[model samples]
Target: MSHAPVLLAEAMTALALQPGALYVDATFGGGGYSRAMLAAGARVLAFDRDPDAIARGAVLSAEFPDRFQLIESRFSEMDRFVNEPLTGAVFDLGVSSFQFDEGARGFSFQADADLDMRMEKSGPSAAEAVNKLSEAALADLIWGYGEDDASRRIARVLVQERAHHAITRTGQLAELVERAVGGRKGARTHPATKTFQALRMLVNDELGELARGLSAAERALSPEGRLVVVSFHSLEDRLVKNFITERADARGRGSRYAPDLPPERAPSFRLEHKRATAPSDQETAGNPRARSASLRWAVRTDAPAWGELEAPALAPKAEAEWKKLI
Candidate 1:
């Protein structure tokens, strides 16, 4: 199936694309954003951590050799490759349609596969996390990353099940979570959805990547350059919201969580839209996945870049344990 870029029109409008201007598609999942940017006559440099995404982009790169390039790396490292200040950059965050639909990739419970959720197909995988991490760490991961209230119960089940045999498959883990959660009757989504999401995010260091990528975008964009992001869940949306609001604040009072820090920095961005833009009902009807997506954007200012964003370490225990395994 062809991958549909969520909020395509909204994101394109946010970019305000200008012909010949260099723009970065920081998450070139299906090259949808890159293709659109190129169509608008922009010079596009796209980045993707997943090797599959890079392989899929070869045709687009070949078609526009002079105008388009696809880099197989994380968006957080974009600053290293982007020599010139950018005209615009867009991030379609979270799992791409291609990743979710391709059952063999192990991104979804729709089809059974290995418990591997590595975006770059490297480092430790979800299976290692499921079978090796302690019960307390698993609970922390699910509660912190997944935000599921039944995280402790789910974690206990994982520990118990894995003792008999390793949780090495997507189907196995999903079933375990479903049983742990008691099926959560009337739930629109699957019982294991959040569990799967948490594991995938951990395996990819997703929130950490986003925090770094936003900072990279801030450093790389020219004055008035657009930085657009589409995030799928509360955690991502909250981080994006805070990043923009904090930078756009003229007071520069630092974060409320860190009140002791000096408020000496100037505003680095202009937040034109205070609220995030969501897909229209019409769009959601066609693509159910668009239901949770939220789009937020900001225009870069002339002020000096701010300090590097620290990825929120929500579950220290889980993270510490997972680090040992990797």
Candidate 2:
């Protein structure tokens, strides 16, 4: 089943579509945005790392063969795939409903399935991280990535429990976390939410991919072309916000060190609006997931693209601790 695109109206309006121009749908989850782009008479290049999404996207490519192409790859690789200047690029980031709903994929705490969270279905699974990794490393990851304050306690419990049996299933892992933090009574959210989120982020290396995708978008967009991104979490939102602010340094706003910021390079983009855009109340009523989603967009400038981007490290201390397991 296909999932409805979040912030649909905001994304489409921000794109300001132009017929016969090239456009990129960077996430291509359910092909909702790609279908809309083709409907607006634009040629679309869609990317999805998930093989299942690419299979689903095949129908759209066939429907508009001349105007659509679907690449079974990550958005970070867009530059390697497409060299053409684009009229617009749209990124719908984070876990897709298709992945979340499929119990076999095991992304949700509510589901009883194998503890697997690989978006591409290849590489180290969450089971490995949970069953392996030091308690300190696990805790650091939870705190840094998931923003869970009780990460140390949760990690300590996971290590103690897994000594008897391998934490191979989502339900097993969830129960361990719940017992550690007290059962979910009068709790605003599930105790395992943060743990699951941290594991997912680490498994996917999502933050690194986001940084690369933003750089690729900056390189590929044409002058006056728009770049629209919709992110579901605060961490994702902060990255997008920083990317735009750094690239669209219109009027001397650089970073926290703006006043002491080094001499400027040629700004490659301009923000259409500074504030983060949110889904309409009506959209949120029908889709609660849209409640936390935030959209940020900018237009490409005539200036040349920046060289390479130096992405932030995912906590050196955590990485050091995790390296012992892998």
Candidate 3:
């Protein structure tokens, strides 16, 4: 099935696009948002690390040569390509369905392919982690990144098995995880779901990229420019939520009697809504992938851009351990 951009209407609404104004599609997965912006009479500069997205985006660029442009690079580097001030920016976080459905990409275990999940197809793949990382390191990665409680058991079994034969295929790795967890029985998700998520995030350095991207967007936007982010998982959402909250200057005050106060920083943005928005029931039913997605947005203020925000801290216990492996 073709991947549908999640929360399309809400994102467009949040952006509050101005016709002929410049905007950035931070992760142009399949160009859905870019196409919508073009239809709305806005000029869009789209970025994606995946060569596939760039190849596909060529069509839109050709069709709207005067209005649309596509950049083949990670969105975190937005400032390098963003010469003109942007009126708004939109980021659709996480991997695209194109990577999953294509059997060769090995994003999904349904097909037997190399256990490679690199979005750019250039870095170390999933197979390397599965085969090389020590069992304890692997456990820490799964425990910290995936938030899976069964990480130890999974890692132990993976280590024992990989010692005899390398785990190089998606099917092989999935089976190993299932065996470790005693197989799925009517579970809505695959047994290896979280572990795979952790591996993908680590291999891509997605969290680090997201932190830098938020800062880049801050630097690129013009006053009153909008920033919208749609994240599918808790880790992604947490980072984005914190980044926006900090930049929007959501302040907390101490009690009247006695208390602590947050340090004052220039309010770089104003929240578009007090809360995150989720997909409607109808939308979720049509595309299950949208079920976990949330859209949050803010409008840029005239204040100067804050310097790069700090990356979200990882689980302290596993921080040093993970660094040794990856």
Candidate 4:
């Protein structure tokens, strides 16, 4: 599956890019958004943690040497990379189709490949976490990240199975999960899907990165600049939604614990729209991965800059339990 930027038009429109305005594509998966920004006459500074993404960007960099910049780093470090305040920034969250389709990347369960689900292909592979983590820790990771209800039972089965034979392949882990979960019934998706998702999130610290990336984006944009984010999963969408809502409403009068922080004194971003925008039926039909995507955007206001917002704390007990499994 080649990477096609999801909601390209919607994201660009939300950004309201101005001619020659500096912009950032925080998740430059395939450089789809970066190319679009350049076409729209905006100067782009893009970041992608994946080396493949960076290498692929070479063509675009050469084509628009003066207008485009590609940085091989996570979006969490966006603030450190940009010297000037940005006119806008876009974040297309979740694993890319390119990553999933490439058999060697180990991002997909459909392909029987090595258990290496690293987004950047540098971090700990899924195989390491699955085979090394303790049962309790594995359960916590599956439940917390994947939202799998039967994580404990699945983890137990994994431990038992791996003890006899180390699980080093995607197919092996998927099979173990299916057997433990009693297999997917007719019309149901694969039973191992959630477990794979959970493991990927943990291995990459995705949620943590999103939290920090949002804050960095908010801090880095110039007043009136837009911050657009497109999320494919509820976990990612929920964080994006809450972050905007909280910041937009943070200044209002309330309890002592939440005293009225004036709007002018609040961070510069103002929620641009009320609800998230979803992909059209046409888009979903063309790209199944776009089916779950939800886009949200906000405009930076002239308010005073605020301190960095803290990333949400993961459930400690669940986190600790998952840590033990690893």
Candidate 5:
């Protein structure tokens, strides 16, 4: 299936695209957003970690040679590649429909295919972790990445199963998880849904990449430049929300010792809206994937540029609990 850019109009408006403006589409999955930007007369620099995306993007570049440049790299490295400050940036995070539909990619549990869920197809595949990692490590990854409640139990089962045969296929791993977790009757979701998600996150280091990419975008944007991010899951959305809130609040000066913490630096971006915006129900009905999507944005300010800020730690209690599972 062709990957449709979720929230296309909203994302373009969020970036406030203009003619000759340098805009970056950080996740150029299928070029829907990039095409839209090009139509708006923006100069677009787009990146995609997936080789398949890059290959397909070539066609779009051919169509708009001067206006579009497709970079075959992760968005985290965008700062290193771009010379001038960007006018705006957009990141539509999560697995694309193209990835999910391609059985060999191993992004979906429905297919009986190899456990190879690398977004870039260059990293260690899911099979490696399933067949090689220790029980504790596997459990930790599932809990930390997937937020699976029964991670330890599932890990124990995988350990036992892998001893007899390498769980090299998606079906094998999904069945193993289903057996361990006990099939939920009448539930639309599969038992292995979260397990697969966790494995993909760990194998690709998704959250880490996202944290780096967001910071890089902040540094790369020019004054009044917009940063638009559309995230499909809570973990991703939380990071976006916190980053914007902390930066906007930090721009204000106050007593450092007071219970209310002072701004660590001049805020780089002004909050665009008080709350995250979601797609209309009409959009969600047509594109089920858009159902969970949330868009949060901010506009870069004229305030002094600040260095990188430390990313917040995942909950210590959760990390501790996750360690036990691993």
Candidate 6:
């Protein structure tokens, strides 16, 4: 009914929290992870780009007082604010339940509302993206971010419909996408789901934030400290997986084709498990949102932090056009 953090126990175990140690909850959505860290007696610093999450966190800040602090900022910028090396850091990536549940936020089409999916409540919204991007860009965004095969069909319809009137409402966009792609008889989800996801990710630059946030955590975590992440989609999971693998030097030396390349960077983090941890059947049944969650964690090593991560240019045409608006 409310926000239940996926993989809470697994993330905590990976953290191996020590009483009085400092921990960072990089995405303090609904204050779930931060609450757990505080309960474990770790001093907590929580960050969220959403103002509502920060307001909700005020209760935890009040209750923990000296033990907890919440900042209303993107997790990517957390290193700038945190001077002390963290004993552990946890990130719960992607949209929070509160955002999806609140129809006014326009993250879902459960209720008709403005097409606005800006996590920070600022910047170019989903409406701007839907109405402004070229057909090719929209198709690319849908395929790249949403992994939807109907992207081209969806984009063609969107362009045709927007000519009569701007696609400015969640319901309006959803209807257009469904009409374009058509419904699958056995599909449980709406045909428009991926289209909406693509628009939302583009609006918020979700992948870009994840890339930067992971690097920030790597830089701020102390040696032996844990870095945990729970991601909801394959795009996010792959990015997290590759980031850790590359940092841990698990990929080995350069390929024979690129033998002239320089040596690999020192392993800054060590992967305790080569594979990601998944939520239990009970957890997935109780909270359908947890079904797609995959948790991967690594322990920081005594090596220097590597250069910052650059978010993959997944949909360059869409991104470039979106940037022009914002």
TM-score of 6: 0.96
Candidate 3 residue-wise lDDT at 168: 96
Evaluate residue 274 in candidate 3 and report its C-alpha lDDT on the 0 to 100 scale. Answer: 66
RMSD of each: 2.9, 2.4, 1.9, 3.0, 3.7, 2.2
Residues 161-197 of candidate 4 have per-residue lDDT tens digits of 8889989999888898989988787726788988889
* Model 2: per-residue Cα lDDT at residue 182: 78
Q: Count of backbone clashes for each model?
A: 0, 0, 0, 7, 1, 0
Q: Please provide, for model 2 over 1-326, each residue's C-alpha lDDT reduced to its tens digit, 9 standing for 90 to 100.
A: 55989998789899998899999999999988998889999999999999999899879977999999999898988888777778899999999999989999999977799999999998888999887778888888888888888888898999998888889999988998998887888887788988898899888888888998999988888899999999999888988888888888745544676466543787899987999999899999998878899999999999998866655665556666555654
Residue 84 in model 5: shift from native, Å? 2.1
User: Model 4, 219: alpha-carbon shift in Å?
Assistant: 1.4
Q: Which ten residues in a row have the lowest lDDT in candidate 3?
A: 313-322
Question: Higher TM-score: candidate 4 or 5?
Answer: 4
lDDT of 3 by residue, 1-326 (tens): 48799999999999998899999999998899999999999999999999888898888988999999999898989989889879999999998878778889888888999999989988678888778777887888888789998999999999999889999999899999999999898899999999888888877878889999999999999998999999999988998988888778774454667665554767898885869999999999998989999998998999888899777656444445446655
> Model 4: residues >4 Å from true position, as ranges?
250-267, 315-326
Better of 2 and 3 by TM-score: 3
Give model 2's TM-score versus the native structure.
0.94
Please identify model 6 stretches exceeding 4 Å from their true place: 252-263
> Which pairs of residues collide in model 5?
136-326
For model 2, the stretches where C-alpha displacement exceeds 4 angstroms are 250-263, 321-326
Per-residue lDDT of 251-312 in model 5, one digit per residue for the tens? Answer: 33465665766566788789958588899998999988899899999998887656554544
lDDT of 1 by residue, 146-254 (tens): 9999999999999999889999999988899999999859998999999999999999999999999999999999999999999999999999999999898834444
Tell me how far the alpha carbon of residue 252 in candidate 5 is from the true structure, in angstroms, after superposition.
12
